[model samples]
Target: MSAPDLLSFAKAVSSGAIRVVDLTQTLSPEFPIIALPPEFGQCAPFRLEEISRYDERGPAWYWNNFTVGEHTGTHFDAPIHWVSGKDLPNNAVDTIAPEKFIAPVCVIDCSADSTADPDFLLTVERIESWEKQHGRIEAGSWVFLRTDWSKRDYKAYANLKEDGAHTPGPAAEAVKWLVEERDVLGFGTETIGTDAGQAHLFNPPFPAHFFMHGKGRYGLQCLTNLDQLPAKGAVVVAAPLKIKQGSGSPLRVLALIASK
Candidate 1:
């Protein structure tokens, strides 16, 4: 009984066998924010007024009442966020199945493509090539787009200049293929949003958001640390705060990558 090594995975608690990788960007005022047209519902950028920094408000406590968009920071997107998935059961973050919050992940390296062009679209052909090397993407695992964009400066990360943000994302066809064919649990990105900067020009527009939500898949954005994981076998933990009737919520995402 004292031999934890004899148990199937008690080794998960053993030293040097597993590691936790933080996959969230810092929720700071300087982080680039998502943009919405002047007419649509607006997503507030994160802002906090220090209630007390170990001072008057509460001598022993330092906290703040902050206002942030449901999609702000390292956040999760529930199906209910878009009208396309509005009617589905458990469509909101508060209602989603808890089991879905933890799962294995596949980080598809797309940083080179993104570096070559800010508007790059992750295509099925590239995924197919990845599979050729990494094996078929297992169903129900997360497919994280690892572009390392989270490492860029705020101006470069957003790449916005009057027209809108310029970022990499899945092609519309690729999103459809992933949802319908690969059966991925969700999509994640290092950029400000999951869709490309100019996705409004694609058919049905914002295809990653459209198809992922419509199919009841989830989204993780404003992510980092993809550079810390291998292509396969990392288990991700992304449990959002239990906000009431939340369209979505910011969260701390962690990944458990296997060690040598």
Candidate 2:
């Protein structure tokens, strides 16, 4: 964009002609984290310790020390998070180009289906149906599956069961199609993961991670307020922390949309 175009955008933002939506869920100990079976390594939940609260430690200032897993709450997943993209260059969070952090987004609303069946898996047919109405998903755009999962209570959000959590996600074929055909920059979800809870049963399990990361694409999870975004036109700003060789990290995701 030219300097004039950039200046107009800045002016629009200041003049309330554009709106900004926060897509990140608040990071707290109460927020649910992805659960793994006993045999597998686990992710740590957000934890904080008060270093000073204007007491003896600090006379007039308050601060804290906190610890959290790389993929804790409202996180970004780099290609290196999975073995499929382990060898890919610039696959880690810090190495990814900064320009990649901002891109147009396509929000696919599957709330009705998700509400009807928690384990509903998005199919290519569904995507095509969406495209028929909204237009084709452009390359290098973020495709966010809006399941309204972020509105559930902590336990209900996780929806853990004897077998596993029963959450909605894209089918393997759908994921493959998104990566190979559409060439999306990444996938986003309001659920705990980019894959369905029962995705383990599918061939090449966790296909979203498999195909997306395998192609040096990205993933965002535990996102909220996806319903606030339009099916097209909105741009997402999802820049993760610059952790050295990090697989993934919690991030504050934001969306910019035109007000009028």
Candidate 3:
């Protein structure tokens, strides 16, 4: 029951040859949220207004109305998000190709570095070493950075202080290489962003977002469950909420790992 295409992948889910991994953080008010500076329009945190918890608002059902930023929690970022991809046609979430949402993935482990320094940046050399062990990262594949960063608590996850949040992510050059060379489908991380927290210091600033999206590539932030995947061969299924003309959207990021 091997999947030759997307439809086969869907069918594999039913037979259990391919398993679904919930690569998302539970969205709730308690989830440690990303903090953006004032002045710029801020991305809202995941907050739910209990429409009914089965006690008051509605007795028959238990549900809530939530307002969250497009990039909140486990989310997807479309090209039109930044000013770079602004003029590109079909740049927004709704306009992205549905097929782009599914692709194979390669996990680059950097747990030791992330543990030592919260602001570690993944370099191109690191990615190369990963390839040496796991075989080449195929074109149109996802390069997920496994930092084991999701194990941290709120205060540590954000690690914000007088300066800003500290987290591990792609170096500017690393992202450029991934796009131009490997031609990865996108990048994913357990941290709050695809770019390192101090990415503003990089020339062009936030190069991961700049080039990745400017080229119509995608991004996944606040991811989890990378440990469950092999170094390669797993396919990612990250479907954003079909918001009209939206820049990005919180999504359920699932990984399909084929069992031998």
lDDT of each: 0.90, 0.96, 0.87
Q: How close is candidate 3 to the true structure, as a TM-score?
A: 0.93
For model 2, the local distance difference test gives 0.96
What would the per-residue lDDT of candidate 1 be over residues 153-215, giving only the tens digit for each residue?
888998987888889999999999999999999899999888999999899899998999999
Better of 1 and 3 by lDDT: 1
Cα deviation of 148, candidate 1, in Å: 1.3
Best by TM-score: 2
For residues 1-260, write the lDDT of model 3, one tens digit per residue: 44478678668888998888899999887777666778667778778777877777788889878888888888898999978888898888998889888889999989899999888889989888888888999999988999998888878888887888788998989999999998888888999888888888887799989989988888998898888989988888888888999989999999988888
Pairs with steric clashes in candidate 1: none
Model 3 spans > 4 angstroms off: 1-12, 53-59
Worst 10 residues of 2 by lDDT: 10-19
**Count: clashes, candidate 1:** 0
lDDT of 1 at 132: 98
Which tens-of-lDDT digit does each residue in 53-134 have in candidate 2? 9999999999989999999999999999999999999999999999999999999999999999999999999999999999
